[model samples]
Target: MNKKRIPLPWTNVYGLARTLVALGTAGTLAASSAETLFRPVATIGDYPSCNSTTAASLFCLSPDDYSHLTWLKWLCVAALLVIASGWRPRITALPHAYINYSVFSGIAIADGGDQIALILSTLFVLPALGDRRRWHWEQPQEQTPETRATRLLALIGISGLITLRLQMVVVYLQAAVAKLPHAEWQDGTAMWYWGSNLDFGPAPWLDTVVGPVITSALGVALMTWLPLVIEGSLVVSPLLPQWLRWWAMGAGLLFHLSIALMMGLWSFALAMAGGIMVLCLPLGSTIRLRADEDVATVDTSPSQEAEPPDPDRSAPSVEQPQPSR
Candidate 1:
């Protein structure tokens, strides 16, 4: 009897998710100066050497000079760009994770987004290591038989993905539950206060458009409580049906987009958007490869009964077709 082939974990769904994360981070770093990102003179509490002591950060390996640090920052941007391009996942996975770690550890300024990026990038390494595809966006061809080693690797990748899902649940759950104890969130005036804040609030033009709604009692209640509801719903989204999961994905993305518009936290919004995709998007979903229409015809059935080998039949080719660009 033939063994059922194990599906590889690297799919276009995850490919898009990781690409968003890489692009968001790369955009942020590429647009900023090294001086703004790295401190000119390292204090005892926050030093460039701290990154080295904490982990094998690329930035830490650079010489303690402004020019060297700038060059290092560009190097990270290039690596992230490669990751965003959906190139060889096996080669870029660890480098992507390392870049995030380096930024989190060495950057003078960072936020929750940076923390999330670090975690996601690290977890992505598991699936990437086992993936045999040239690009992450390519679906595994059905003709390829799974070897014992490949099956084991796929299992490891699935475990990592499940862990990532649970982590996202915890993140959303914590965000909602933590807000319950706060007076602003409780009284439904949180949106008002946040909108009117001097820093990190809505821009002047945006405030003009949304100012009235945020200040009103009804709008404040809806704006404030809606986030809690949405976040709470996301925490339990894994238990939801596939259709509901898609809705949750949409709602979660809209929520983050609003945050980006209101508070100018583009990187944060992008990071959370990626987290939402991993949490709610089904892993089995595949992208339609226009160049390779045959992918759609590939049988993904879990098991099929095998027939006895015939001496007259020839062995199938071991080679696989090249994936479409």
Candidate 2:
């Protein structure tokens, strides 16, 4: 009797999501200077908290001097680069979580993206810890027998992913539902106000292109209500079929991209894009594993081959001579 094969719950299904999260946080830090990210004044306040004896961040582990801080920031970037490259996930997972936590807790100015990255990176550590592959993108070999311990670890990792998915659903649901009470969102004037803002508004060049449309009443209604519709759909995306989930993912990404373009929230867009992939993508179903494909080929080969003819079964037997009988 063949032993049942136990599927490892942790696999390359979330590889892209991990990479995107790492890149988003890394890009934000790499693009900014130490001075901009860790203001001298803010550092004074946050340093003690971040550098506490128990929960010290890499940033807070050292002196808050500009040169040292700069070096630390770059080191964090290097670690994130490793994570983004999908290498040695078991080694890099905790470091990735630590880096995001440092950025969120130690930075002078942070956004929603930073918080999301922190949450996701931490959650990803569970899956990464359970995965035995050197690279996060690697699939397990076919017919690999999982030990009880490994199976438990994989289940724990999968639980973390499920929690992450539920968190994403709540995030979008709250965003859409919370906006319902706002007068501007209700009246459809929110987009116009946001578009016309000086600090976070679209660049002058972009404004020139979208100005006419945003200024129109119809455009305002669409812009304001469209996000609510998209966000609501994303909230229920887990229950949606694969195709609809994909559509929701596309719409969510587009929505975030528009914010990035208009409000210069590139990090936010990247972080949310990763979340969308986690929320919408069906686990273990996105990429076909080479081992599985090989198995499939092997399974079909026998059917394709013409069976050898059974001489006695396929051919009529000659009648035996009956004269002696």
Candidate 3:
């Protein structure tokens, strides 16, 4: 049997989603390492490090022990970078997920984005165990049982991506719903309070420009109601045409980008961006064959090729010419 190359684009989609989740988690952890590692509130020395909490943590050392925590953090970062770069993803995925789970476990408070990203990290491990082939560029041989299993694994991984997109839409819709009863969200004045705060708002220089604008009725509505509308729209975005779905995802991306730039929530932005990639890629669609493969098909049965061609009987018969003519 001749081996055929199958172009399964969802494999690439899954791979990209995996990379984004891994890299986004790594970046978020790296950004918040100081607090996660040694903060007074949730350091490795915290009372619940080993005994009280049900959550699993990598930082099980005594609060006084700083040396081991430092080494472990750096090692986790290294492993994350390797996963993000797509160099030896199968080997690094376990460590990436473990370290992230442990860190979040030890922390006093965890962001919803980070929690979801950690879950996605664990999900990628299943796909990594099956085949070491790179999904973004090439796929393994097709039609073999092993290849089919690998494809199944890849589908499982892509399902994780789909789950992430659904999770994001749910989160957004939930937020919007929660705000429905609040007068601030309804009157479009919520941005005024949020934008005026020094902790969550833009830096002093930028706030000077952004503050006044948000205080106005139109600006407030734009900032507050726009998100609600966008979030509601995203709930149905997956059902839209692929191009339109991408446009909706792009809008979500812009919303997150604005939050990152204006509100200084980089982790949330990155996590949302990762979810966007899952929807942007062609995850649910079937693969298309190359032009050369379009006209080529394998005949699995010898009898199929040996079958006689059908005769046509619909045409009119021509008159025979006489010998004298």
Candidate 4:
């Protein structure tokens, strides 16, 4: 096929995606930790950690020690703020990633959202480090050695983003796959059981309001099959139409929103939504090289010809004065 392929603004696309994931991580971290500030370890007891004498090597201080850990938590919060502000990401990104890692390693109980934030925070920093250029939204450029080098670096950054994006798709697909062996999912009655369970279901008042509708056979089937199909379809996003891809991503966003509202899995929902932001990126522009025939046609076109001068509109040329010897 003699199809002409256009170049994409990979660096800028990575930059835009990184900005969103960073900001989303920041928000998730802040929201998740907000309650901890009001209810300190002193009041709620220490977070379970492996801080015994033998495990002392794992962490410097006792797991319960709030002295340094509290300060570290605040530091992470500050770093996240700086990153979200779009201040020099090269500097702040490392610290933000480190803090997120520390939250999981230093603490005993880390939410699934923490893992999501940590993964994104770490991956984004690589692109930020490699990207020495500013983000731009402008006309595509002609290829040059310098442009090629820039694109190469951009490819490196984009590779990481692509890895993360594909990883999310795999995770969702795996979840659906795993459920295939379960009778509830196969029978389309899983949502009914989930909604009926008091421990994991909606609150008492909410259950009373929405219980009957959600627990019905049709409701259960719809809820179960919709997510399975939606998540499974994401794997083939590139093959889908552009508008359909967007709609899929948007549906994923709403799915997470519903999870947060009904299931109270806010962190997981936000984290998943953050990853979907990558798929939601607008298509980058590609440079379309003109064919030789098109170029020749353009060159010969009437628009390329100079207009004939009008005698009345033309200015008279001045005669040169001759110098006498």
Candidate 1 Cα deviation (angstroms), residue 280:
0.9
Give the Å error, residue 115, model 3: 1.2
Model 3's alpha-carbon lDDT is 0.61
Alpha-carbon lDDT of model 1: 0.76
Clashes (N, CA, C under 3 Å) per candidate: 0, 0, 2, 0
User: Which predicted model would earn the best TM-score?
Assistant: 1
TM-score of each candidate? 0.84, 0.82, 0.74, 0.68
The better candidate by lDDT, 1 or 3, is: 1
For candidate 4, lDDT tens digit of each residue in 133-213?
A: 433222223332445555665556556766777777777778779989999889898888887776668877677765876
The global C-alpha lDDT for each of the candidates, from Candidate 1 onward, is: 0.76, 0.74, 0.61, 0.56
User: Over all chains combined, what TM-score does candidate 4 have?
Assistant: 0.68
- State residue 110's C-alpha deviation in candidate 4, in Å: 2.1
Please write out the lDDT profile of model 3 over residues 4-28, one tens digit for every residue.
2222223444555666766666666
Q: Pick the candidate with the highest lDDT.
A: 1
Task: For residues 143-211, write the lDDT of model 2, one tens digit per residue.
Answer: 445578766776677678789999899899899989999999999989998888899889998998778
- Backbone clash pairs for candidate 3 read 45-63, 58-102
lDDT of 3 at 141: 34
> What does candidate 1's lDDT look like per residue over 1-325, in tens digits?
4343344566776777789889878977888788778764445454354543654777777777879989999988998999999899989999899898888878877789888989988988888877778888777554545577767777787678778899899999999999999999999999888888889778988888788898789998899999998998899998885557766878999999999898877877887887788787545345443334544332211111122222222112112222221
Residue pairs with backbone atoms closer than 3 Å in model 2 (clashes): none
TM-score of 2: 0.82
Give me the displacement of residue 318 in model 3, in angstroms. 53
